[model samples]
Target chain A: MNNLVEIVNLTKKYGSNVAVNNLTVSLPKGKIIGLLGPNGSGKTTLIKMLNGLLTPTEGTIMIDGNYVGPATKSKVAYLPDRTYLTMNQTIREILDYFQDFYADFSRERAEEMLKSLGIDPSVKMRTLSKGTKEKVQLILVMSRDASLYILDEPIAGVDPAARDYILRTIINNYNPEATVLISTHLIEDVEQVLDEVIFMRYGQLVLYTSVDNIREEKGKSVDAYFREVFAC
Target chain B: MLGKLMKYEWKNTWKAGMLMLLGIFIVTVAGCIVLQMPGGVVSNLVDGNEANAAQTWLVISSFTATLILYVIMLLASTWGMLIFLGIRFYRSMYTDEGYLSHTLPVTANQLFLSKVLVSGVWYLFIMIGIGISIVALLVSLMMGLMDISELSGVLTQYNGNVWEFLGDGIYELNRVYEEQMGMNLLHYGITLLLTYVAGPFITMITLFGALTIGQLSSKHKGLIGILAYAGLTILSSIIGSTVQSVFMFSTNIVSSAGGTGITTNWAYDINVLTSALVAAIMYGVSYYIMNRKLNLD
Candidate 1:
C-alpha cells in the first residue's frame, strides 16, 4: 500500500521541553490509525504537525508525495480538540463559510448530520451545549472530501451517546481513499475501528504497528498494549 | 479566494463600520444645520437681529461642522479599523477558531494580503465619504439654504490670492467642522485605517520573530511570545527614530540654504514622504517575516 503521510526525523520542541523527538513514521493510505499517548506524550503535537498547524523543528512531513504547504493544507481536514467555531455564528453561516473556502465541503452532508443530531443550523454556536458544538464541528470536518482527516480528541468532552455519534460520523463520512488519524486517550472506544496503532510516550514513538499484527503476535489488543507500553 | 476572504471580513465588520458611519453622518448633519440656522429664513423667524444671527450661525456652523467631521471620522475610522483587523487576526491565530482559517488552503501571504486589501479599501471609502459630505454641505450653502454668504464673501475677497490667503484654510475649515461635531473624523479616520492596513503586516513580523525567540527562550511559550513582541517593537522604534532623525537632519541642512532662498514649504512634502517611507518599511518587514519564517503551528 502507498503511504499517505511520511514524517522523517520530525522533531518539535516547546522551549526546553521536546514535544516530538526525532520521530519517523509512514502511514498508509485509506486506513484508520489511532495515535495513542499519555497526557504529555506529544499526540497533539504530532497531529498538529501533520495538519501544517505546527512546523517540525528538525525534519519534514509530507502529505502524499508533496510537502506541507497550501496545497497539502487544502487536502487535510482538521477537527481541533476544542470548539473552533465563533460563538456568534449560526451553524448555517459557518457551513456557508466552509463551502465558500473549501471546494470539497459538502453542505448537504453537513446539514443531514446536524439534523440527525437534532442540531438547529440557525442557532448561534454559543447557544449550543459543548457536546453539541463538538458534534457540529466534527460533522463539518467529516463532510469534507479531504485526503487526510486529523481529529484531535474528537470524543473527549462529549457524552457517550454523542461520542458514538461522532465515531459513526467519522466512520461513515470519511472517503475510502483517505486516511484518518485520531488522537485520543480513550483507546478502547476507537480500538475496534483502527487498522493501525501508533503508541507515543513522552514525545517519542514507542511503537508503530498494525492492529492485526499486534493482536496476532502478542495475543493482545491495542488498548491492552497501550496500558503495557505507557505503564508508569 | 481573496474575494471570499474580503467578503467575510467585510460582513463581519459591517456592523461596526456602519455604526461609525452613522455617527459621522449625524455630526455632519448637525454642523450643516447649525450653519444654515444663522442667515436663512429660520433666523428671521427667531427673535434676534437677522443679520447678526446670520453671521454668528454661519461661523459657528462652519466651525462646528469642520470640527465634528474631523473628530468623528478620526474616532470611527480608527476604532472601526482596529476592531475589525484585531478581531480577525486574533481569531485567525491563537485560537481553535483558526482551524477553518488555516485549512482554507490559502497561504499566509494570501491571508495577509486579503486583510490589507480590505483595510485599504475601507479606509479609502471613508475618506471619500467624508470628502463628499463636506462638499455636499458646501454646495447646499451655495445654493442659498444656509447663510454661507459671509464665508463665501471672505473667500471671494481673497480670490486673487485664494491659495495663499487660504494658507491651509480649506483644510482648517474641514478640521473645525470635524471638531464641532465632537469627532476628529478625518485625521483619526485616516490614521486608524492606515494603522489597520499596516498593523497586520507588523503583527505577522512580530509573530514570526516572537515564535523564533520563543523557540530559543528558556521560558514558556506565552512568555516568549510576549517578550519577542516587546523586543521587536523596541528594535523597530529605535531604528525608525534613528532613520527619522537622520532624514530630518539632512533636510534641515538643505532647507537651511532654502531658508535664505525662495523655495516655499518643501520641508512639508519631505516630512510626508518620510513618514510614508517608514510605513512602507513596516509593511515590507511584516511581509518578509511572514513569508520567510512563519511557523503556523
Candidate 2:
C-alpha cells in the first residue's frame, strides 16, 4: 500500500511527561483514516508534530517522500482545533491570504462552499458566531487539493446538525487521491465515514485496521467495538 | 513570500502607527494655531492690561491642561512602539494565531524577517513624526516668546540671504573645530545619524527574541514573555555599561584615582555597538527557538 505518511519511532515529550510514545504507524493514501483516541491520548500532539507545529523528542515524520518542512507543508493542509485566523480580518481577506500562500487552494471552490452556506465573504471573522467560524475554517481546509488533510477535532464541540453539515462538506469536497486524517474521540458520529480506524490509548497504539475488518471479525459495529475496547 | 508576508503584516499593523502620527500632527498644529492667535488673553495679562484677568486665568489654565494631556500621549506613543510590536509578535506567534502562522508553507526565518521589517518601518515613521512634532513645538515657542516683527527684522539683518547666515554658522563651527582637533564634527555627525537610523531595528530584534523565548512556556506565556524582555534588556544594558566603562578608562575620560576628566561622548558609541551585538545574539536565539524548540500550546 502506498503510504502518504510514514512515521518512524515517533516520540514527543513535555519535560518528564510523555505525550506520544515510541511507536510508529503508516497511513495509506486515498483513504479516510480516523485517529480515534480519548482526551490526552497523544492524538493532538501527534497531529501537531505531523503539521510541524511541535518538534519531536525523537524519530521523524515524512510526508509523501520527503521530511516535513516548507515543501511538505505546501502539500499538507492542516485545520487546527482552534480558530487560527485573525478576528480582525474579513472572510474575503482570509480567502485572499490562503490563495496567496497555498498553491493547492482553490478560491472558486471556497467561494462556492461559502455561497452554499449563505456566508458572506465581506463579513469580518469577529462578527461570526463560533459555529459559523468553525464552518468557515472547515470550508477553507476542505477546499484545498492537498496530499494530506489533517483535521484535529473538527466536530468535537458543534451540535449534531452542524456536525452533519461538517461531515457532508468533508465528504463532498474530499479529494479522492488525497489522504484524510480526522482525529477525534467521538467515534460513533465519525465511524460511518471512516475507511480505517486507529485506536490510541495513553500515547500507545492499541489497534489499526479497516472498519470492515472490525465489523467482520469482531461481529460488531466499529462504534460498539470502540466502546468495548475503550470502556472506562 | 517574504514580501507577501510583510505586506500583510503592514496592513494589520498600520492603524496603531497612523493613529499616533495623526495625534502628534493634530496636537502640534493646535499648539501652533494657539500661539499664532491674534490679541491673546495671556499677552493682555502680561502687559499689565488685565482687563479680563478671570478669563485670562481660564484660558491659560485650559491650555496648560491640554498641553499636559498632549505631552503624556506623545511620550506614551513614542515609547509604546516597542512594547506594541512585542505584543503583536506574541499574539501572532504564541496565541491561537500561531497555529496558522507555523503551518504556513513559509520558513520560520521568512516569518520573523517579515515582522521585523514591518515593525522597523512603523518605528521609523513614528520616530520621524515625533521629531517633527518637537521641532514644530520649539518653533512655536520661539515665535510666542519673540515679537514676530522683531524676528523678521533679525532675519532680514542678514540681507534675507539664508546661505549667508548658514555660512557664518559654518565659519563659527570651523573655529570650534580648529580649537578641538580631536573632535571630527563631520564624522561624529555621520555616526550619530547612523545610530539614530538603526536604533529602531536593533531594538525590534531584542523584543522578537524575547517573545520567541517566551513561546517555550506552556502557561502564562505573556507574563513569561514580559519577564524575558525585562531580563534581556537588563543584560544588554549591563553589557553596554561595562563596555562604556572600559572605553572611558582606556580613553582617559575618567582619569587615574577616579579623578573626573571627560572629553567626547564615547559612551554613546559603546552603547550603540553593544546594542547591535545584543540584537545579533537575540536574532540567533530566536532563529534556533523558532526552528527547533518551537512548542506552541
Candidate 3:
C-alpha cells in the first residue's frame, strides 16, 4: 500500500507547551487505522494539522505526495469534532455545498443515506437534534469518495446506537483504495473495526501495530493492551 | 473556485444585505408619504394665524416624527451594511464554521479575494440604494413645499434638453475647477468616487488581518483581534496623514507651476492613490496571515 499521509518531526506548540512534540508517523492507503489516545494526547491536533486548520509550529506534513494545501484538501475529507455546518443552512443546501466544493462528493449516496436515516433535506441544522446533526455531518463526510478520510472523535458524544451506526456507515462507505484515520479515546467501541492501531501518548507515537499482532503477541485484546501500555 | 466561493459568499450574505436595503427603502417611502400628507409642510406665511395653530402643530409634529425615523434608518442602513458584512466574515472564517471554510479546496488568496469582492459589491449596492432613497425623499419634500405649477414652470426652462443643460452646467463646473485647482471636475469626481469605494475594502481587509493576528492567541482571540484593529487603525491614520501632507506640499508646487493641467489635480489623485495603496497593503497582510499563520481554534 502506498503512503497516503506522511509526517516528519511534526511539532505543534502553544506558547512554551508542545501539543504535538517532534512526532513522525505515516499512514498507508487501503486501511482502517485507529489513532488512539487518551484526553489531551494530540489526536485532534494531528488531525487538524492534516486538514490544514492549524499550522504546525515546526516540521512538515505531506498528504498524497503533496504538502498540506488546497490540493491535499481536495483529496482529504475531514470531520472536525465540532459542528462545523452553519445552523442557518438547510440539509439540501449543505449537500449542495459539498457537491460544489468536492469533485468526488456523491450526492446520490448522500441522499440515500439521508433517506435511510429518515432525515428531511429541507430541515435547517438548528432544528436537528445533536445526534441527528452528527449523523448528518458524518453522512456528508462519508459521502465523499475521497482518497483519505480523517475523522476526529466521530463517536465521542453520541449514544451507543448512533456510534454503531456511524461506525457502520464509515465501514460501508469508504473506498478500498482509500485510508480512514479515526481518532478517539473509546478504544473498545472501535477496536473491532480497526485493522491497524497507532497508540499516542503525550504527543508521541508509543506503538504502531496491527490489532491481530497485539492480540497474538500479548494474548489480550487491543483495549486491554492499551490499558496496560498507557496505565497511569 | 474563486468564482464559486464568491457565489456562495453572496448567497450567504444577500439575505441580510437585501433586508438592510429593504429597510432603507421602506423608511424612505414612509418619509415620502409623510411629506405628501395633507398639511404636512410648515408654511411661514400661516405661522401666526390663530385659526391654523392646530394644523400647523400637526404638520410640525409629522415632520419631526418623519425626520427622526429617517435619520435612524439612515444610520442603521449605513452601519448595518458594514456591521453585517464584518460579522459574516468573522463568523464564516474565524468561528467554528471556519473548520469547513478553511478546509475547502480553495487557496487562501482565493478566499480572501472572494470575500473582499463580495463585500465591496454589497457596500456599493447599499450606497446606491441609500442615495436613491435620499433623492426620492428630497423630491417628495420639494413637491410638498412648492406648487406643482411653479415647479413645472421651472422645468419648462429645460425644454426636454435636460442632458444638454446638465452638460453645459458640467462644463462650467469643470472650467471653475480648472481655474482654481488646475484639474477637470470630471476626473476629480471619478477619483473621489474611487476613494469612497476603496474605503470599505480597506476597512474589511484590515479587520481580516486583525482577526488573523488574533487567532495566534490561545484565549481571548476576539479581544486580541479588537486590539489589533485599534492598532492598525491608528497606524493607517498616521500613515494616511503623512502621505496626504507630503502630496499636498508637492502638489502645491505643481499648482504654482500651472503647467501640468489635469494631472496636477493632486488632491483627489493623492486621495485615490494613497487609499488604493493602503487597501492593497491590508490585503497583503491578510493574505499572508491567512496563508501562512492561520490558527483557527
lDDT of 1 by residue, A80-167 (tens): 8877788898889999999988889999999988888788999999998888888888988999999999999988977788778778
Span of 10 residues, lowest total lDDT, candidate 2 chain B? B254-263
Q: How do the residues B14-131 of candidate 1 rate in per-residue lDDT, one tens digit apiece?
A: 6766766676677667656654543354444443544556566656666666676767666776556554555456556545766566667887667766766665555555555666
Q: Please report the candidate that would top DockQ against the real structure.
A: 3
Candidate 1 segments whose C-alpha is farther than 4 A from its true place:
B39-73, B128-281, B288-297
Give TM-scores for every candidate, taking all chains together and pairing residue i with residue i: 0.76, 0.91, 0.92
* Clash tally for model 1: 32
Q: Rate the local accuracy (lDDT) of all candidates.
A: 0.72, 0.86, 0.86
User: Once model 3 is optimally superposed onto the true structure by TM-score, how far is the C-alpha of residue A203 displaced, in angstroms?
Assistant: 1.2
lDDT of candidate 2 over A64-88, digit per residue (tens): 9988888999999898899999999
- Model 1 interface CAPRI class: medium
TM-score of chain B of each: 0.53, 0.83, 0.83
Candidate 3 residue lDDT tens string, B151-203: 56756788867686778889999888778766778777777776667766767
Can you give the lDDT of residue A224 in candidate 2?
Answer: 92
B126 Cα displacement, candidate 2 (Å)? 0.8
Listed for every candidate in order, the interface RMSD values in angstroms are: 2.1, 0.6, 0.5
Q: After TM-score superposition, what is the CA distance of residue B77 in candidate 2 from its true location, in Å? A: 1.2
| Residue pairs with backbone overlap in model 2 | none
DockQ (0 to 1) for model 3: 0.88
